[model samples]
Target chain A: MNFSSFPKESVKVEEVIDCIPVGVAVLDTNLRLQAMNRALEAMTGFSREEAIGIDCSHIIRNNLCTQKCPAKQVLENDRAVHLEGNIVNRERQKIPVMIHASVLKDDEGKPLGVIETIEDISLLRELDKKTRITHDFADLVGHSPKMQKLLEILPIISQTDSSVLITGETGTGKDLIASVIHRVSPRAQGPFVKINCGALPETLLESELFGHTRGAFTGAVRDKPGRFQLADGGTLYLTEIGDLPLTLQVKLLTFLDDKEIIPLGGTRSARADVRLIAATHRDLQAMVRQGNFREDLLFRLNVVRLEVPPLRERQGDIRLLMEYFLNKFNRQFQKKIKGFSPEAIEILRQYPYPGNVRELANMVEYATNVCHESIIKQEHLPDYLGGPWDEALRPEVRATVGEMGSYPGLEESIGKRVADNRLNWREMERRMISEALVKSRGNRTKAAKILGWGRSTLWRKMKQHNLV
Target chain B: MSEKLLITIWRDQVAPRFDLTSEVLVATVDSTGEPLHSKTVVLPTVSAEDLCHMILTEGINTVICGGIEEEYFEYLSWKKVKVIDSVIGPYLQALELARVGKLEPGAILREEASQG
Candidate 1:
């Protein structure tokens, strides 16, 4: 196996090395690049001529190069070494590579040099990322048992054209589930139209849902197709279904029974081939008992019901969702903020998100925007959560100003308030700002910074409080 | 009229991939295709989005690189920046041809001796 004893022209070693798909480099006993194949040259962005005689560490700038040189170890031990590491290529992109280094030996068992092979794993890494994203149903990422059960039934539900009623708390991804159902349904190719029943007044909402003809109202100068007609051959999602007026509920019931709709001021009824999906955050059964909602209409829309679990019920999803959103926002903002500090993560895990998944997403986005460091800290959280409150209770549900004096502890005072009671959240917020200002000696800028708020917000708060 | 040209570089050569290039050479040329000023910028990380941002913020009218992804190519094109990609050659030779407005997309300037 001595280089001097081997035939000089038996094989073109450089050509054979260049022919290999993976990158290959032959280093001298001193760990200098004796020769590099074309693949190695391409991977490192250094030509063979430029790479020759250069220090192997300088050419392959990897994390292990400064600490443990595999080539140096292979030369020392006269054995092969394999390592999984990453290299920052000439393009400045860090690529994961598998390095296999073996000592080249002479006939007398003397080490000549080290031959290293590098296999780029960029494609494998990309596939792994894709697999991670696809593990969830569509884009709704959750792996908790509750979420898993919901995901298991989604495909089956999407197979049908029946009307579906989705119930969840506000910001619990009801609208997202509706869209996911539409996307996975047979009518996926057709348009998916959505309208919020509570967003408009009764008359406007009626016209928006059901179409209008000329002279139907003073503002109606032309014919218009409503959501049902627009969603023909597709799916129609009605958000905030609890807000649909009792009178309009009859029209919806008729459409569900006969699949026909009569435009305002039009004599003839038209057929609409649209699947219906309704979502509501309210207790429709309670509304039914209170005579606020028609039971028959509820029955029609509730043919198939999907209940989305709140974030508190599925606490395991918090970290998963946090990481998902962290990666998402990192790509969006072009920032490389890696993860949250232990304290920040603990605070997030402990705090119950009343606003559900949407709130968590907003929290991540806010932290990403304000966090200049690589890791998000508790200080980067929203100002309300900066306090020592166990849960993020809505300000309106917390104890009133008068009751605040009764409880000695701040958390107990905040936690003592009852639900369904009316308290002006803005007034409470204003009072808190006033107290902070007084504590800071009326320095608005200092108070604003201490409150994790901008100077303009403090000024506006002061104006609203008549403390200007 | 003066125009700015950006070339993605790797070890004194045109990098084989645009998205992977960490360093770039930006040259300002006058109406006669003579370089007025030139400078090199090293990025902290490799990213097509960051490269697009640099192309826009630095007012680069033309870009020379290799193997650009379709998204970045279309984005740069939409931004009205002329992109000459898939170039294979030494950095100095690419600059010389670019200064004379003779560097074309997919141009190979490597010497015959180096072709294996």
Candidate 2:
């Protein structure tokens, strides 16, 4: 007859003898190893002949499961127990492991010691570490498919130390991208130094990029380390590369070309083992054509071009970024704000964000400070954002019946004729407002300044014109 | 229906003291005497066709402006709008003059001029 008809105890023995991933052991009250499977032999580097009838401690190398171990805790307490930590393999290398034990008894309900199983968890722990590192940059918020694509491409790009050129409108996260590149690169342990080419004059920019000796200039009181020197063996981000004055462009090109820098007022040239990353909002090719920029310099910087699309093109990202900044500012300012009201978010979505991510960040920070309730209301947003809230209150169809008939009684025929001759005031107003909004990025105060109106006057006009 | 013409006056040329050097005023008026519409654009310069397109978009058929560049005037005349030359006034005044029929087509002769 087939042994498949065998009783439960025999099956229990057979099942324990065949379980694959786990190393199972059966022991009596004396803690002697009774039975083990092929998996146990593979896990412990022992055959059945060597393992059977041996003390369980011989294989686990502990004196209590080897002294009062997890198995003992379960046996003494008559409950289950679990323990996790590193375990040494046959080669004596530490492998992460987990163990669980439960008391095993005969039909008479007497405690027959415990049965324990061990599982190697080294690969799981490694996967966990990898996941945590991946999650580290998730806090850098952006959700446009373009941004998502950029993020997707970042790791592949980070694997190599090729020179990268990041291009976008002002306030786009070019510097943040540079940081991400550095963090993911092999040089992550080294320093990351950043220099703004537009912030300094040409003479000073030269000294800042390449360190100077004592008395390099009239005011040089001592030797100073430039960004490249400070970022040796790491990454150096040169921002506004388009603005690097032509006189300094040659020096920068030479340094990037030769991987060396000649310090001001110094005869010796120093090797800089720095990875070059540059960012600019300006059109370098147009500048090259205009003869204001160096063509060689452009070629050197555009090795791996990363173009960050404008905010308007990526409207879906706005809400994600807004919520991220809201949470960030809530924690920073110790506020209890929940998030933007639907109306406020709608208004924000309609805005054509010329200032890009930086402007959105500033708005969130500003609103968080002034919000009283958990939910950020429209009024809490700066006037530029809330200004459009008033606009939303107006009828969605912009052309009103009143505006349609307001023309002086020239018959619809004569009115159309007169309207044709009349200054296209409405279109003109719309164009002016659009240009002003673009220049100011929805900031009514700045837009008002551009339009030659006081703050209060601008508010009144926004209300009057239904332009909020 | 009679056709209409469009005109655009350079903001700097219209208002000498304002910082609106980058703006252009667009107006749409019919050939005889009816007000159509007007708008402002922030552009470096305006050409005759730029003015004509602005008016055509609003269905206007007549054009008027102050200090027409010779090239633009010739192009505008060729495009069938009465090109008003040597006229100088405030933007609204020019429109009102166009409205009341005070401004008339003085000279429409063609002359060689720089396209720019």
Candidate 3:
């Protein structure tokens, strides 16, 4: 409704500006304060009487006032300008504020003065900081018993400067744990240098861990600082430590003992004050037993160890992790998806996550990117997780599962999925192995021949499937 | 009764902030509080620590500035220097006030405001 057509009520300009709950200052063409509301007085700690003849820059003491000012833009461009800036108050405390400056016009379109509004955003900034601090602690979100116990001890472990060994299966978040340790440790402000021992060959891996002098070997044209030198006064996180060659292992042990690195082709040793954190998916003890790894090096690196559990073993964390990743993907893709449907949740719960949290995170990211509707349904899940299983649990597979004696629980579970016409491949492999064993009449060599496999392959499969 | 004073300056007006001021007026006052000699020193850049160093090295006993934070205030105080902060407007007027021992903290001395 137009005010001229409705009614012309007497409303005081000062009262209107005061009741708006923001600082309002009216400045002349000279940008000197002409008038201001009570809120401006409170925001700036300068009363209207003392601030009237003074320049607004002196009163506000903001970073932008000496630069291309908003009020000047309003007068020059004849339009409003909005900006974010910080102002120093009378007490010397800094406050974040959003400013809106517009021109106040007289009759017949003549510009009179500039009207500026300031909104303090300290509370909003504090809330944003709080949310980031909690969710961004290496994104370690979980509630299962295993995860909760790990979380409870992470702080205590991070306080020390010992070599940490983080062992977990692929995609089980061992790298995240390593980062969290460095972030919370006393060396937090120091650099965190990471190198994948498996990513490079033995020659390059050696030069990468310890610095090399010029002309150390081919392609060694320049002097280089390795991870140890780069991580001076910090941490060096060696991932896939199991992949490190035995020669490099002895050198690493020497560095850990002497705190010195004699770079390749360099005669003198340089000291490096570095803490070490190592991670791997392979079992170092098994590798040692096979004579492929150094047992003494393993003992040195295992001063403090963190074993991250797999996603399937963390039964209570599946839904939480799925929702967390879904929310994360929603933010990344700029979508407002609520959550997964009940049917999708049921499928996700039943499906085994052999690749652990990383796989689940990827699945959620894919579904969130493709899902157009408000809620994610079972159809939105990856095909390998959904309907492919509907045709997998055949009658023949169920008959074989039934013939496998003394595992009624497995039989019943597969039997239930068989009626539902869905089964994972691991169960099917177990049943096939049992059939091979029955056909061979407990002869390992005959069972290996029946399965068209090596004797050790059959033995490892038996151990994995608990057929022994 | 002779004393030395430093006024952070911008053009003829006192700078709105001490941290942003690039030049400062250093004056040596006599027994009656009148200036014996005055000089304007241009700084390399705007830095609070450099300005504080200049204040100490120049043997300035008092400082007239605009909008100084508590940290610099306490530091200057701890060093036995008196800081008259939050004083706005022309440097001459502020210098005159200091000459008469009348310049106080948070003093506003703008001449006219409504010049379009």
Candidate 4:
């Protein structure tokens, strides 16, 4: 920015500089303290009278003053020098400061003097440290509002040992969330044992979870540790828990209530200190009505429920994921795929990702392997996603593509439709949802798909807006 | 008992900063306000904590240096040690001032070394 633009006819530059909260110091050609502001005096614990003739380094007392005097460097190089370092004040406290130094010259370009600005950044550093601690969510990438909000709170929630129940559609990265929870949890060093309830028969699943004695089963070779025992002092992630047999759900509920698990054919029960993190794409509440899942287990696990929004619901995030997966696949395939063509991006944006991120990753990987060109064009993409946009993409998905540019007259149309100029954002959103429902003939599933929201979220919002 | 004083040094001048100072001149002064014996000690590295520990362990009566952090100053004061901080210019002039019991904090003595 231009600081010299201050009207010089009425105000003196020194008057302006002196009033600034940031400490500003002007050094003569000798790099001595020629002039300093009030803030500088208060910062260094030395009055301007005591500091006037001293060398700049001795007055500022920045730790890097002697080794790499920023002012002198700016003078020699005739360019700006910026650095962060500790400065000891008159009170003898080490304060973190950002120093900016540059040379001041006359119209003829004669090197006149150096001007340096020192800003206390202790608060900034402290805040940055907090943000670093709270958002240590590495490797998870999403810039959409819903995903950003979820990512922001993930680290804080992971600090607790509460049993987390993650619900989302298939291919929505539910397993990744479970892993992140275990990775960042307090019991991160302990073994993270994962079991798919649907992957095994009910008889074998019980033994696999609550280890059996050697003679308990015909095929049992020796005494074995159950998943719960094996996962002691750590986390146990049960995926597809909806598919778990009703009997096993009761056993899981017993373990939840009292951290004791009885192995098959074993009379004694062993206490397992395992933090539970279960995930499923299925609606367990509906399954409870069908007499499949245990209501008590559902209540226990639902203490902390995280709903991972489907890819279509996370607006403006598809591009971010596309670039992320493209760059990722580029390295794995040893090909320099710059990016997708605008036509491909338009098509990808219009189509609703039914399988979400996992499906997108597959498409990118397939294109990376097949494409001979640097850019991924329309033909490089999977053949399934390449057909006519209207027929291939759902009308509900195309209606709520979410980008403002897609509906060029959106703001104007909203303004024209609403008679009151004071109508707020929430009102506009309600109006849009109402119109989408009307257009979808009051079919909630289609309306929800049109609104780019999960059915549960849409239902919740509908109740909030009194449209239920 | 003779009083001992420590002066943080950067070359011949008092160091511009105490935390970054590596060399110091320690003087055992007699009652006449002159050094009975003096030696310069070079630290392996610059550390305010180490210097403060040395000040306490070595039984130094006074500390004379350039800009020092308040925590160290308060710590040494809490320990009953005199700290003459923020003194610039030659260590010889600063030491002589401290010997005469006239050296003050924020004293920027030049090469001419005027008593005033």
Candidate 5:
């Protein structure tokens, strides 16, 4: 083949430029497209032949073309110009791009044309936005030292396909962290299947986790795929793993060993490509020692254990979570309650929320609903907080109250009524409803609002208690 | 049968990129290639999906543009619209070729005198 007939230097230059990953375009002094690499052709959806002899602006229709032409700038200044802009591609999607343009000079140092390189930064921009929203990890919101450490390791853990075990008290956001791990993992695009092992009985839980074929059991009328099958190519979050029965634990251990699941009453085992993430509020180690949990299964799941700090331990995040939920509920319920009063905030800070962040969120929600004024007051809180400061200090400090001042009003009222053999919860509820109705001038809706109960709920309660 | 043909336009020539073109010329031509009605439409913003919707809504049978992505090309093809893409030349010449049904894909119809 007479390869010499081809312009060797031009062909070599084209090949070299084409090999470059980023889009590159060469324009003549008149800003007409003289040449462009395959990357540029793909980026702009303009073929080399179609792009040649056309205005570069027409080929690369970018925001900068009309506003700040880097090529034109380079030509005028005889220097390199760099810019970040967006280009509308063939799909009409605006791709964030960075362009570097420099004047192409001849041997005589006279400007011949301009060479420009374009890079698509859309993915980088998307990651930057995600990082901002996640505060380093996806959906894991906390800046406390413990949370910060967890966030630091979350990315590293997400990179692997190993089984993860997250241990935290109830309402400490274990599910949230599990999902964040899945979202940050390579299998983010795949399904994230979650099941509470404790929520179902042993027989039902087995079928739920490993699926069941038709006629597998008495009620198995049709073939059903389970969590493992649903989470193929993704992550399966098994919450409350401590409650998994011993027989189910053995099966789970087998599945973990072989990455295969045998559906109930099925003779054959099928492969499942799923990353397992387990969570439990109970002490699995103690369960293992007590023979309630299998040691082998524990070893398999406890390869990496992440402990989520309780809300009381991370005191710094209390206000942050309060403000976050306040904003969130404000948008949801259309209320503009400014914030908690100083006394109310002090009470919240001193209170040891055994239910963790979930309890705090509920408290804020209740306050937001009952608060008629700009700020959340102590009176707006749930009665569990006790009547007032004096009422809270009367009782000996309860274990559940932590080191905070005691909630004496709740204890005294319940204690006195129980001691007198007259602590009828029904009677007390009826009296409370009657009081609320009288305060609202017998208006059920106003009464419901005052009591922080939905109108339908108040109506149902009234019917149940014969208050209507 | 009178058929509608749409051409993406830029300046006096066909737009070099289909998705970037903000203006289009739609012409209704008779079986003999004689123009029955012709109008130029300007889009509020350039968008390929919007343009596809417009094409479907306007009952355009043929589309003439410069370059197009494979997905949009396949989409319009799937919708049974004839797409003559990668065309480079003055708009009138391309329009004339389309009228006679002689225009080919990747056709470079710019005369030597008109070459830049």
Candidate 6:
């Protein structure tokens, strides 16, 4: 009789033995089992019955694996051992397994019993092993000189334990810089705390930064650790530092000056071993002069300043960022989009990113969801990102005045533009003066010569424009 | 490029409600029409005060949002971000009006509005 032609029960038992998901055992060194299929349960019919008390030799046709048996390698060596698919079943089929074995030894190190666990990874074996690359840091993609300079300095910045101030446009990844600093720092093992100064109200911001005790205010019921306290022994990052209220500026400065915090409604101060990193898109120096920000605090925070260039300024990074986000959203939304069309990429490159990196990511994610084809075309992006073909591509510059005519409407359109006009003029003159100044390298005479203006006229213009 | 014209536009509630705080946008031409830079700054209370301070201390020339209060106009005139008061409209239209030197003060400057 062919064992292959055995009844369904026998075949089921055989399948259980040969194809059991994980490792199984029927044993008796002296704890006798009448019969077993495999030294490692090669074929699985034994479900706590039929094989218990059966002799191993009669089933597997192999005696109790001794010191030399491959199965007992770990036990014999008295060391932890690992095994892969090596065990053979009664059906002579091989099955994948990982056996972690350690000796069950007596007090004198004499062997007593042996045990091992097994894990099957046949599914893993069948898989093609697709590579998974995360896009978390991919968000920080850039290869421009400015970005390269930043990347080079990031490790250096991380090495130092000084307070850092990051300045850039709104979406220029100032937070990314802080995070990268924390990740690359010696204190990487410590927690990284982030707070948006612009997001919270002044009253809540104080409590959020320094934490508060029970009965501190109407909302405080229990003692809570503020961001500074929670970030102790780590790094605390404050974004939009320019928006911080004047009242909190004093307290924040005190914390930075001395590594101590006074919690709301708490009597004494507590030490907080945290590194401070602050960022803002605004001109803090101007704020300092205006007395909105404390000059002393600005000095404390600007110990090491890192400037993140805006996306439009670093056009080289656009393609890379687009691809990174495309691949990410593809995997995320489980779409089969190939990539962006060349035209689409061109449009992205040419478009001045007013909103910067965060906006680019949002646009890419939106395009991925809306586009019908495998590749994203220019049309798939929002109208603002496209060219003149789309009406929304340009800023709302009305031909005639008083079109909207409402106070706020007029304010939004006209007010900003009038300011833009004067700024545009000043900017133009400033740029010309600077270019002339740079070429002349601080030579008032040569700058006058290059611009072809009379020496007195140049001097007067410099004084009037404050370019001197 | 004929030196790109830089203009500062202002509106009555522009500074307080949004970050119209010295946001400089470039004026360029595409196929459609006059295009301004996309970025804008909303002056914070402190920064607004700072802008006011610049006029006082540094004597920096300022382009006000359309129709600043009289005292602010007076204070700014005294301090000097050369308060260019004009009628509020679309940014380009406002700039054009300022460019031709046709922009005129729409209302008498008030001390109360300036204090706020």
- Evaluate every candidate with DockQ and list the scores: 0.02, 0.00, 0.34, 0.30, 0.07, 0.00
> By summed lDDT, which 10 consecutive residues of candidate 6 chain A come out lowest?
A128-137
Candidate 4 residues lying further than 4 Å off, grouped into runs, are A1-136, A389-468, B1-116
Residue pairs clashing in model 5 are: B66-B86
lDDT of 2 by residue, A1-468 (tens): 122332368446836557557777766555656667776667665566555554454454321232357766776788887787444333324455677778777667777656777777778977875674586477557777888888788888887988999998766788888888887787776899999999998888889999898888898889888888999979999998888999888888888888888888888888788999999888889899999899988888888999987776785889888988988888898888877788888877886554667777877887898888988877887774555322222111122212222234423443343454334665677678778878999998899899997988878756766787
lDDT of 4 by residue, A1-468 (tens): 122331342135457688899999977667777678888888888887777766777789898888898988997898999999979887887889999999977667876678899999999977875665445465577889888888877887789989999998777788888888887777776899999989999999999999998889797889999999899989999999999999999899999999899999889888888999999888899899988888889999998999898888889888998898988888887889899999888878876676678777777888889889989888988775777432343222333333223345443444443434335556877898899899999998999999999889888988878888
Minimal lDDT window, size 10, model 6 chain B: B11-20
Interface RMSD values, listed in order for every candidate: 9.0, 47.6, 2.6, 3.9, 5.1, 45.3
The sequence of per-residue lDDT tens digits that candidate 3 reaches over residues A1-468 is 111221122135566787879899877677777678898899888988888767888898876887778998888999999998878777777788999999877556767678899989989977865564455463998899999989988888888988999998777899988988887777876899999999998888888899799999988899998899999879999999999999999999999888898898889888888999999988899999999889899999999989998877896799999888988899999999999899999988886555678778878997998899999998898776755443334344355444334344666666677655534566787887899999999898998999999999999989988987
> For residues A1-468, what per-residue lDDT tens digits would candidate 5 score against the true structure?
112222335456667799899999877777877778999888877788776766776677666774478988998888899899877555545678999999877667777788899999989979875774376353466789998898888889988999999998777899988988888787887899999998998899999999999999998999898899999989999999999999999999999999999999888898888999999988888898899999989999988999999887785889888888888788888998999888888888877665678778888898888988999898998776754432332122222233223334555544553444433667888898999999999999999999999999999989989887
Residues A223-335 of candidate 1: C-alpha lDDT, one tens digit per residue: 99988999988999999999999989999999999999998778889888899999998889999999999999999999899999888789589999999999999999999
The segments of candidate 2 whose C-alpha lies over 4 angstroms from its true place after superposition are A1-132, A219-222, A388-468, B1-116
- Per-residue CA lDDT of candidate 1, range B67-109, in tens? 6766788889999999987676677788788888899976756
Ten-residue segment with the worst summed lDDT in candidate 3 chain A?
A1-10
Q: Please report the candidate that would top lDDT against the real structure.
A: 3
Residue A331 shift from truth in candidate 2, angstroms: 1.6
- Give candidate 5's error at residue A8 in angstroms: 34
Best of the candidates, TM-score: 5
* Residues B1-116 of candidate 2: C-alpha lDDT, one tens digit per residue: 33443334443223211111235565655556675666776653222344445544654445654333355555556766575543333445555666666766421111110000
> Over all chains combined, what TM-score does candidate 1 have?
0.48
What TM-score, computed on C-alpha atoms, does each candidate reach?
A: 0.48, 0.46, 0.49, 0.46, 0.51, 0.46
Which docking category, incorrect, acceptable, medium or high, applies to candidate 5?
incorrect
lDDT at residue A283 of model 6 (Cα atoms): 81
Q: Which candidate has the highest DockQ of all?
A: 3
lDDT score of residue A60 within candidate 1: 67
Candidate 3, residues B1-116: lDDT per residue as tens digits?
Answer: 78999999877777777888898999999989867999999997677877998888888999999888788888999999999998888888899999989999988776621221
Can you write out model 6's per-residue Cα lDDT over B1-116, one digit (the tens) per residue? 22122234333222211112343323333333344433343333323345565444432333534323355556666643455553223454544554445545432122322221
Candidate 5 residue lDDT tens string, B63-106: 99876767788899999999998776777788899999899987
